[model samples]
Target: MTRMVLGAGTGLAVAGCSREASALMDDYATVSQAANEPVAGLTLDNSQLMGIREAGLQRRVSGFLSREWSDHFVTLDNGAILVDINARALHYWSEDERTYKIYPVSVPLSEDLTRTGKTSVVQKREGPDWRPTPNMLKRNPSLPAYVGPGPENPLGTHALYLGWQYYRIHGTNDTRKIGRKSSNGCIGLYNEHIAELFGMAQVGTQVLII
Candidate 1:
């Protein structure tokens, strides 16, 4: 139920009314806290969360998650979607509709760091440029490189700045690489899939990472 607004003044900023936000968070908490050792928000279980319930879904079923079918944008509260920047996954729950969807994605990271441990959607931009921060430069002395937006640019299509961190969950030129935990730290998503995610999210949203 985490609502992520799209096309806000900041462009891709997420917002939501408290009532709606509370419902989504509560549900997410239920899922994340299911095993008691919850992380931040929710880490979806392919079995219960996905279509792993039906007895007939054994042989052909792919753990309720796969490249097709469940491969869709997940909208969170206030018009935001829960983005798995590492696994390049998007998670959302249908509120009035009463259902949930998950999708594989690809996002780019800041050029400053050689790699990253994880990523988040804390900061956002319209056509953002990669301005390597001092800390980033500190990580890589030869950094502070300015990687602008465009084709051939490391930030392939979309860009979701990671708060103050020098990372982003954006689109990528690499389409073949998705649904895996691969990245210096940023989330890489397929071009079309991320577009669906970007369309579903906005600013001021809470991006909980596990």
Candidate 2:
């Protein structure tokens, strides 16, 4: 198996626009060529190397392995979404198995703030409002009670409400958080990515966070 170094700064930054996406494609193309060569330090295995190449094909920014729906779900009836917290990536598969997409994401800031298990998309909202959860307010008393839809809103352009209370898979105005551990118990995507996902996902979509 091929092995490559996992340097601290080794990661891909995905931009939210097509032009930037093209640039990332070029960058990944250059990196993929080196996948088979062994690197001298802390290394990742062949599967990870393949993921880097697979991510490039989708024209999305991702720094983790691609996932298979069969590995997490028995059926993709209403479509399925798999949020891999450790990978900081979200995998989606259409009900017909005709569409698959992966997006870089932001996960909970700490283990205590994270909740993992099965859930479903209970609601889908465009221009969604933002209100810090009660626990969020307790941690930061200065937090506002409500925020309307707009660029300033923390929820960004769209949101997919999960079956779990106070949890959601939503867009972020703060793009810097993607591919990092930076959410408050929720998963976050780029505003553009979430908007696209919002259009593709439905209320009954299955979700599995692992």
TM-score, cand. 2:
0.73
Task: Evaluate all candidate structures by whole-model CA lDDT and list the values in order.
Answer: 0.41, 0.70
> Per-residue lDDT of 111-139 in model 1, one digit per residue for the tens?
33234332335655544555545654575
**Per-residue accuracy of model 2 over 67-137 as CA lDDT, tens digit each:** 56899999999999998888777888899997777776778878998999999999999999888788877
> Which segments of model 1 are wrong by more than 4 Å?
1-76, 83-88, 94-100, 106-123, 132-144
Best by TM-score: 2
**Model 1 worst lDDT run, 10 consecutive residues:** 30-39
